[model samples]
Structures are given as structure tokens and as C-alpha cells.
Target: MRDAGESPLLVAADTFRAAAIEQLETWASRLDIPIVSGRPDGDPAAVVFDAINAANARGNSTVIADTAGRLHTKGHLMDELGKIVRVTGRAREGAPDEVLLVLDGTAGQNAIQQARQFTKDANVTGLVITKLDGTAKGGAVFAIVHELGLPVKYLGVGEKADDLVPMDARAFVDALLPRAA
Candidate 1:
């Protein structure tokens, strides 16, 4: 984002998970980006709402919130995601321009099922498949795009921030199915 001349404010809203806030704080510090965080076990929605306000006040162009990892089977968690979206709208109309759901590349068919629920509940506009550097060939990537019809916006190839690269459909397909010699 810096290279693009856009300022981003990271929100540590994954309060339910241990060290989630610290992890984001470390990233924010390393990237020299600003961040807003709530107290441990506090409301994730509130954290995001505050982050938006902070970003506006600080002249940040975007607010990227890392919400708690949730399962489709958990109704309450899904409800919480909806609440966050509603609160975000209340914070600023048409805010959260994009909601990207990050999925585990190694999850295989299970990733599709999770994407379905996330898209329905959070209105996910795109997907980010992580851990592609592992043994997982990301065979499920096609299934996810076919099943959810949402674009795969990015791929997480490694641990560094730079590892998250924009998706190249042809390249990704080529990697999944290399041509015979």
C-alpha cells in the first residue's frame, strides 16, 4: 500500500484469539502503519468501528481489520460478523469497500463450504488463499471459485507481507497443472 501511495490503518479486532492483537501490532510496527486495538476479549465490532474513526482522523486511506477466525458451523460467530458489517456501515456509509475472506489453501473441499457461509454472512467480495508455499497444491482453488463465484484476489505464498501477491489466474492454473515435458 505504501508503494501505491495509500495509507492503511490496521485493526486488531481478533480479540478472541490469544496474541492476535500482539501479532498485528508487530506487523503494524514493522510496516510503520498505524493501528487501533481493543481490550482483550473486548468486542471485535467495536474495535473495527474505532479503527475506522481513527483512520479518518489520521488521514489514512484505508482500514484493514483482521477479524477473529470463525467457523461456518458457529451461528453466533457468523452473527457477530454480520454485526460488524452493520456497525461498519454505521461508522461510514459504503465503508469496508471490500470484504476478503482468507482461506487455508490446504483445506481442499472444506474451503468451499467455509467460503459459502462467509460469503453469505459477511458479503465476502473476494478470497485470499494462504499457505500455498506448503505441500498443498491448492487444487481446491478452482472448486472455491466455481462454487462461490467470488474472485480469488490474492495468494499467500509465504510468511512475509510481500508473500501476499495479487492473483494471476493463468499463472495459478499453470502451477496447479504443469504441462508435460
Candidate 2:
């Protein structure tokens, strides 16, 4: 759910799962994207196993591998995330070969570190930073885009889905800098 006074979705894994499930279900009646979910019981191994199996069941899968912010720790999450990627990659033709992991961009060093480590050797297609309009260090976009070797895909500019706008390189640069016109 969106936090009051902020534009980001302050969500835990389970909460996020619930919301995705609801949105998917609503689509059958109101133009929705396909959705599916199965609780992984907070077991890292089990989650990885189920994700692979799910991919097999559907021929293609999009996995969002996450950890308990408390138990996984930054380093551990990064390590396990790599494992999740490897497992999915090795699946048979019926299973998914793509996985996208979402990170809490505003969660300070730990979150950033986890993201950094996860992408260092693994293939992470993009980054979606939340609370873009609210972060005091919003300028850190430079660090993320330049140093992290990742593309900033989705910026949570507001609470609604439509508030998201893909970051265009030239437009974003122009908007970030002062202009004469």
C-alpha cells in the first residue's frame, strides 16, 4: 500500500503478492494482466524450487525473488538472489528463463548494497526506484544509472499506476538541469 504523505508503495513481499493477485483476478472481469501466485512458506529453498516448477507448469515464468528484510541481510540476499537466477536459468525448455527482483531503493546502504551485489554478476534487466518524488537524495539517480551499470526503468512518481513514466534519457536530462527556455 502507499504510505501516507509519500508516493511509493510501502509494501512487504506478502502484501505485494496479495495486491498482484487481486489485480490479476480483477482483470478477468475488467481488462487485467494474467496473474498467479503460490505462497512459498518463507523458505528460501522452497521458494526457489516452486519458482522453477511454476515456470515449468506454464512454459514461461516471471519470478520475483525476495527475502525477509530482517533475516536475509544485505549480503545474504544478494548471494541467494544469484542462486535464484542460476536455478531459473538452468530450467528445461518449459520453465522460465527470466526473473526480475525488485529492491527497496530508499532503504539506505543495505538495499543499495543488495542490489549492487545481485547485479554485479547476474543479469538484471532494469531497476525500478520507488518514492522518486519524495527522496531527499533523488539526485542519486546519477550514481544508480552511471555507477551501478543498470538502467532506471520505472520511477514511482506518484501513488497511482499511471503516475509512472518511462525515463527518457534526453527528457530526463533536460528536466534535471536548469534551462534557459
TM-score of 1: 0.97
> Worst 10-residue stretch by lDDT in candidate 2?
6-15
Tell me which residue pairs clash in candidate 1.
none
Return the top candidate by TM-score.
1
C-alpha RMSD by candidate, in order? 0.9, 7.9
Candidate 2's TM-score reads 0.58
- Clashes counted in candidate 2 amount to 1
Residue by residue across 1-181, what tens digits does model 2's lDDT show? 1223322111112322335434434532342322333343344444555655654576532444443333234566556556645655564453333333345546655555555655674566676666656643345556655777677776667766576666676766665675996
Q: What local distance difference test score does each model get?
A: 0.91, 0.50
Per candidate, the number of residue pairs that clash is 0, 1
Give the runs in model 1 whose Cα sits over 4 Å from its true position. none
lDDT of 2 at 97: 38
**TM per candidate:** 0.97, 0.58
lDDT of 1: 0.91
